[model samples]
Target: MTLRHTRPEARPAWRKSSYSHNDGDCVETAPVRASVAIRDSKDLSVGTLAVPHDAWTYMVDALKG
Candidate 1:
């Protein structure tokens, strides 16, 4: 679903994907404890997608396939 930071000002340092397009349609991610936080680069105020560490690895591997 959606994940949100309690304090909007205290956001983690999110990094945009290298494959992101020049347009605003990009995704950003930040590493949290045992999980990864994903969000839209164009709208950080919306919310985040929290993926577990193992799940993230699996998803990446699958995408590379």
Candidate 2:
């Protein structure tokens, strides 16, 4: 996959994680280019963390560790 460093002008389609509860502190993710866009569910207007597929996999693995 080709990776391009670009930011979306409009807001991304943010979705709350299934593990999120009504209490808040939710995480959201969206597809942006060849990377996964991650942002706080409460702050959609702010910037998102652009993670490449490989890095995203590593992140998930680390989180599971």
Candidate 3:
């Protein structure tokens, strides 16, 4: 995947979900080129889950509905 080729410094900055309550149970997200990455906010080593941009949008829209 293209994400693997992304340099650490070149990766987009991750931001925690707005719904997060500043607790340990938060998730962070970042745009990775055409995809969006989600990861545990409490542990950087937990790994990331990347989803297609459209899929991410769909999920967000569904939740908002």
Candidate 4:
């Protein structure tokens, strides 16, 4: 499936990973429209990834493994 590129301004909220460290390691997420928005905690303005709720859950579960 092809993912659409979303503009940063289009995102309503942004969240950071609780497990993130200040040493340039971590990710953040927030609800954006019907999906979730993610960005690097270290550089939020630069790297953003938008994912659907179902895919987000699968990604999180995979990360836990």
Give the top-scoring candidate (TM-score): 3
Which residue ranges in model 4 land beyond 4 Å of their true spot? 1-11
Candidate 1 Cα outliers beyond 4 Å, as residue runs:
1-10
User: RMSD for each model, in Å, please?
Assistant: 2.7, 5.6, 2.6, 4.6
Clashing pairs in 1: none
Candidate ranking under TM-score, highest first, comes to: 3, 1, 2, 4
Candidate scoring better on TM-score of 2 and 4: 2
Top lDDT prediction, candidate number? 1
Per-residue lDDT over 1-65 for candidate 4, one digit per residue giving the tens place of the 0 to 100 score:
22244786754565657777778688767786777777767665585677899999998899999
* Selected candidate, larger lDDT, 1 vs 2: 1
Native-vs-model 2 lDDT? Answer: 0.73
- Clash count in backbone of candidate 3: 0
Clashing pairs in 2: none
Note the clash tally of each candidate. Answer: 0, 0, 0, 1
Q: Which window of 10 residues has the lowest lDDT sum in candidate 4?
A: 1-10
Encode model 1's per-residue lDDT on 1-65: one tens digit a residue: 46556987766778889999999789988888779989998886787888999999999999999
Native-structure RMSD, model 2: 5.6
Residue 57 displacement in candidate 2 (angstroms): 0.8
Q: Which candidate do you rate higher for lDDT, 1 or 4?
A: 1
Ranking by lDDT: 1, 3, 2, 4
Candidate 2 backbone clash number: 0
Model 1 scores a TM of 0.76
Name model 3 segments beyond 4 Å from true: 1-8
